[model samples]
Target: MTALGFLYPGHSAEDDYPRIEQLLGSDIRLPLVHTDIGEDAHRVDALLEMGSAARLAAGVEELRLSGAEAVVWACTSGSFVYGWQGAHDQVRSLARTAGLPASSTSFAFAHAARELGVRRVAIGATYPDDVAALFAAFLKDAGVEVVAVRGSGIITAAEVATWDEEQVLALARAADHPEAEAVLLPDTALHTASHIQALEAALGKPVLTANQVTVWEALRLADRRVNAPRLGTLFTKEPLVQVH
Candidate 1:
């Protein structure tokens, strides 16, 4: 099996990873290790602490033992709150420690957008508006345009985990913009595996969620892809020719 390691923060909505693994099929494995999340707070200082090298490093041995071909930092807010360069540095450090390819959900969104051949996207964030704006800025640095951003102002990952399907759909709809090519729900703590199809159908466009893109990013780092149409448009076919 091609195993992908995931370093998750605290405990909320991580079950989505297993659900996605099942959907992707038996040839793949998603081994997850929970990293210490000092504070579940959505503030930048707290997030910076959460995704620290020390915390991330604490989980690499477990993943390496699981035979992971690639690793991913599955917390979106934790990664993006560090800004683009910091996030890149974070992943680089994790990769070196794990002795494998590594990425995070933040970069996953940027690459996933490119895979869909989409330049403009709208963000539906569970973070407070200030934290959400940081995500918008991170995406801009990656060359993806943020046409619109709608934040729920939720301060904690634990709170986001309690959101139901209706709320998930609402956020995507609220974040949608006429000029946007896709909608992004950027929070790893939110449960989105089961709602991807529904979210896209309701929006009449592609909806990329945190957990969805995290798995996809792991696959990309492993240099592999699989067709799982039920997961949404991003997994329906081979990677699209990237738009300039």
Candidate 2:
């Protein structure tokens, strides 16, 4: 089995890992490590504060014990709030500390967008508008264009974790623009693993959510391909020439 490690922030959306493993099937093992950040880590500043290299390095150490070939920082805003160049430094620091290949959900979304042959996208952000803008900037740095955006003003991941399929789909639809090739949902806290195909179907276009891209990026860094069609176009599509 291909073993991948994910370092998620806090206790929110703890079910997403098992859901992703179920979606990706039993051929892979997704060992996870949580940073022990409390529920108060809902705001961008608090999330970033909890996402120090020291915290992630500790989680990576635990994940290494489970034989993880690669590690992914699974928090979107936690990395992107620092901007593109800063996020790169954070991943480099994580790679050094973990002694394995490393990447973040921020970079994962950008890389996944490029891999899907999408230049312009709409954003379904669960964060406040300012935090959502940072994600748009992160994608811009990666050479992707944000044609439209909609924020839910959700202040807490605990709240986002409680969202059902209908809520997620509504955000995705609201984010979709005529100019957008895909809808990008940029919140790892939101439960997106089980609703990706449904979102794609509803929008009649590609939909890339946080946890989905995080897992895809992890597999890519580990050089493993799942080819699962249920996970949306990111999994089933052939690669474009290296855009990263």
Best by TM-score: 1
TM-scores, each model vs. reference: 0.98, 0.96
What RMSD, rounded to one decimal, does every model reach?
A: 1.4, 1.3
- Model 1 alpha-carbon drift over 4 Å, by segment: 242-244
Error of 1 at 184 (Å): 0.2
Report backbone clashes per prediction.
0, 0
In candidate 1, list every pair of residues with a backbone clash.
Answer: none
Model 1 poorest ten-residue lDDT run:
235-244
lDDT of each: 0.93, 0.88
Candidate 2 stretches with Cα past 4 Å from truth are: 38-42
- 66-128 per-residue lDDT for model 1 (tens digits): 999999999888899889999999999999999999999999999999998899999999989
